[model samples]
Target: MLDSLKVTVLAEDSVPYESPLLGQHGVSFWLEATAANERRRILVDVGQNPDALLYNIGKLNIPLAQTDAVVLTHCHYDHTQGLAQILRAIGKRDVPVIAHPSLFRPNFITAPFFRHVGVMQGDEPADVHAAGGCLFPVVGPMQLMPGLTTTGEVPRVSDFEEVGIALSTIDANGRVVPDTMPDDIAIEARVKGCGTVIVTGCSHAGIVNILKHSVRPGERVAGIIGGLHLVEASEERIAKTVAAMSEFSPSLVAAGHCTGFRAQAAIYAAFGDRFATMGSGTVFSFTA
Candidate 1:
C-alpha cells in the first residue's frame, strides 16, 4: 500500500474564486503516490484544451516532465484531446499511457447532428507514440504499482444509472449501436491509513458502478474525486445515485466537471461536511 497520496487538480471546469489558475470544460489530475522510499507520479487526463491545462500546470508548479504515467478514463474528447501534446510536454520516453483497448474507436452523437466526440485528431495513438508515450490499451484492472490500479472496464450493475447521453458508435456490420462507454474507469489507490481513494474521469460507466467495482472487501472509501458526467441525468436517477453514495458513507466526495449543479447540491445535502467542490488548483493530501 502507498504510505501517502496526494491529488492535485491540474485542470477542471472551474477555479476557486479569484484564483489565478485557468479553467475549462474538462478534467485532469496529477497524482503523487508514495510507498516506503519510492514515489510515483501519474497524470490522469489532459482535458480538451491543452493551452488551459498547461497554464494550470505551470501555475500550480506541477512537475509535468517527471510524470511516470497517464491514465485516460475513456475516449471522450474532453478527456483525451490534448493527450499527445501533454505526453510531449512530459518529455519522457516510453511513459505508460493506459486506457481501455477500445479507446480509439469512433464514438459520437447523432441527435445533435452527427458529431464525433471521441479522441481528436492531434491526440491519436500515432501521435502519442510519436511523442514517446507507450500506449497500454487494457481490458482488466491495470496494476500501476504495489498500491495503485485502474478499475478498467467497470460493470454496469446499477439499474438506475445509465450513459445519460445519446452517444453511439458504428459496428463492423455497419450498425449504429449505442456507445455504452466500456472504456470508462477509475483510479483505485490503497493509501495506508486512508483506506481506498478512487479518482475518476467522467464516470461514463456510471458513478455507482465505478464505486461498486472499486471498493474491495473490508475497505472503506476515503475519497471519491473527479467528474461524474451526470449533467443530463434524470432527477430520479440522480436521487438514486445520491442514495447509493450515501450508503457507502465515504469520507469525502469532491466532484466537478459534468456533475451538474443539481446533483452537486443533492450530494452536498446528503454528505454535508464530507462534500467538496473540486476545481482547478485544488489539492488534497493524505498521509498514512
Candidate 2:
C-alpha cells in the first residue's frame, strides 16, 4: 500500500555542507509517505530548540501546517523540548502526538554530570492540548499509517547493547533507579518492494534489540537511519553491534546525532559503500 517515502533531517548536531540549515544538539526528521495518491507528513521529533527546527523547516521549504502528526521516540528533553513551539507553528490544526505512556516520567543522566534530561519542565499535557495536539499514548506495537508502525517498547535481548550507565529515573517511592528506557521506540516503514526501513532516535533501548522486536521473520531491512546511541560504547560492544547489523545486510545505514564518530567509523568500515553520510539537512528518498 505504501509506494514511496522521503526523510529529511530537520535538526541534528552538525551540518556538513554549505547550507543555511541550522544545527542543534538534538534530532528531528520530516517524514513524508505516499500511498494511493495520498501523502502524509509526519514529524518524528521536535529537537531541543524551536528556533533551530523552525529555521531548518523554512530552509528546507517544509510546510509545518501540513504535518499530519508528531511522534516522540522518548521523553528526553532534546527530543521533546520543541513540541510546544512546533504546535504553535502548526496553527489551529490539532495534530496527533504519538508516544509511549511513560514518556513524561522524570529522567536524568547521572554519569558525566547529574543533570535533568527528561521533557521540558511545566504542564506538558496541558501545553499539548492548548497547542491543538491530541496525545496518543501507546504501550505496544501500533500502526500509524498503511505501512508505517511504531516499534513500541523495545526489549533488551542483546547482551552487548547496554542502556548506558548515565540514564536514571525517579521511581514511585521517589528513589532514583536505572532507567531501562522501556519507552524507547522507533518508526518502521514497510516499503512495497524495498522491505522495511527503520527510523530511530537515540536508540536507548538498543538498535539491534529494537530491530529484533520490530521486524518480522524473513522481512529484510532495506535501510536504517538516525541515532545509534553508540557514542559512549566500548570497542567490544561496538564490534558486537556491527557484527549483528552485518547480518541484516541493509542497503543503507545513515547514522548521526548521538551515534558518535567512533561508532560511525566502525559502522562505515563494516558497511563500506552502504553507509551513507548523515547530518542536518540530509535527505533520503526510497521508492518501490
Candidate 3:
C-alpha cells in the first residue's frame, strides 16, 4: 500500500470560485503516489485543450518533464485530444502510455450527425510513439506501484446504469455493432491502514460497478474521484446511481466534467460535505 496519494486537478470542465486557471470540456489529473521513500508521478488523461492544460500546469507548478507515466481511462476526445502534444512537452522518450487495445478503434454516435468520438487524429498510437511515448495496451490489471493498480476492464454488473450516450463501432467482420466501451477503466490505490481510493474517467461502465470491481473482500472505500458520466442519464437512473453509491459509503465524491448537475445535486444531498466539486487547480490529499 502507498503511504499517501495527492491528486491535483490539472484540467476540468469548470474552475473553482474566482480561479484564474482555464477550464475546458474534459478532465486531467496529476497523481503523486508515494510508497515509502519511492514516489511516482502519473498523469491520468489529457484534456482536449493543450494550451489550457499547460497553462494550468504552469500555474499549479506541475513539472511535466519529470512525469513517470500517462494513463488513458478511455478513448473520448476530451480525455485524449492533446496527448501527443503533451507527450512532446514532456520531452522524454518512451514514456509509458497505458490504455486498452481498442483505444484507436472507431467509436461514434448515430444521431446529431455522424462524428467520431474516440481518439482523433494526431494522438493515434503512432503519433504517441512518434512523440516519444510508448503505448501499453494492457488486457489485465497492471500495477503502477506497490499498491496502485488499474481496474483493467470494469465489469458491467450494475443493472440500473448505462453509458450516458449511445455509441457504435465496426467489428473485425466489418459489421456495425454497439460499442460497450470495454476501454473504460479506473485507478485503484490501496492505501496502507486506510482503504481503497478510486480515480475514474467518464464511468461508462457505471460508477457502482467500478466501485464493486475495485473494493476487495473486506476493504472499505476511502474516496471516489473523477467523472461519473451521468450527463445524459435519466432521473430514475441518477437516483438509483446515487442510492447505490451511498451503499459503498465513499469518504469523498469529487465528480465533475460530464457528470451533469442533476447527478451532482443528488450526490451532494447524499454525501453532504463529503461531496466536493473537483475543478481546475483543485487538489485532494490522502494519507495512510
TM-score of every candidate relative to the true structure: 0.98, 0.97, 0.98
Residue pairs that clash (backbone atoms under 3 angstroms), model 1: none
| Model 3 global lDDT (CA atoms, 0 to 1) | 0.93
Worst 10 residues of 2 by lDDT: 117-126
Error of 3 at 230 (Å): 0.7
Deviation in angstroms for 286 in model 1? 1.6
Candidates' RMSD to native: 0.8, 1.3, 0.9
lDDT of every predicted structure (CA atoms): 0.91, 0.87, 0.93
Weakest 10 consecutive residues, lDDT, candidate 1? 211-220
Best by lDDT: 3
lDDT tens digits, residues 1-288, model 1?
A: 999999999889999988999889889999999998999999998899998999988888899999999999899999988888888888889999999999999999998599999999988889999998999999999998899999988989988988879999989999999999989889999999988999999888899998889897678889999988889998899999999988788999998999999999999999999999988999988787
- Model 2 has an lDDT value of 0.87
Question: Residues 172-201, candidate 2, lDDT per residue (tens digit)?
Answer: 999999888888999999888888999999
